[model samples]
Target: MTLPSAYTEAPARRFNVGERVRVKLAFPPGHRRTPVYVRGKSGVVERVCGAFANPEELAYGFDGNPKRVLYRVRFRQRELWSDYAGSESDHLELEIYEHWLEAA
Candidate 1:
């Protein structure tokens, strides 16, 4: 069995803090990290966590290029978890990569 390569090894550009963006979840049949709780959710750029090598590439026996970018995206609890119990002002933080975001 083989899995499709949905992501590339290219490093992505960094986004500014407080930038508004959306998260695009990439889930395959057998394994995934992006939880079902936050698929296609919108959020704000929080902190930049730096570079991360492609885990999928490593698993596929390919030493792909390291992906350099930011992480820790903050989203409103109401925006992600639909049944969020916290106040409207409350937000959630996610360690997202550059590829997961798009203009919202």
Candidate 2:
């Protein structure tokens, strides 16, 4: 699928590379793109993945307008799991939509 031609300009972006952020802990009903594992976890913004139509909205057959900025966030493996036994440098990156993130 393609974005509407009217969406030529990119939407305003939020977080920036290397900025600390926290995933929202919300458990709103209906389709969601944010993973449960990352909820309320802190991470650094690895990079901006550009804006796209909200997948959660699209799943409901609604036009995802006013694109949401997408970001690749990096989280230490240990932060996501209290029982993690991996190296301290281990990290996981997830492409999360801006709506699911908040200032850390």
6-102, model 2: which lDDT tens digit per residue?
Answer: 3223347878778999999999999998999999999998777788999988998989976798888999999999999999999999989988999
Kindly report which residue stretches of model 2 are placed more than 4 angstroms away from their true locations once superposed: 1-11
lDDT of each: 0.66, 0.86
Write the residue-wise lDDT of candidate 1 on 9-29 in tens digits.
334565766778887765666
TM-scores for candidates 1 onward, in order: 0.71, 0.88
lDDT score, candidate 2: 0.86
Model 2, residue 83: distance off in Å is 0.6
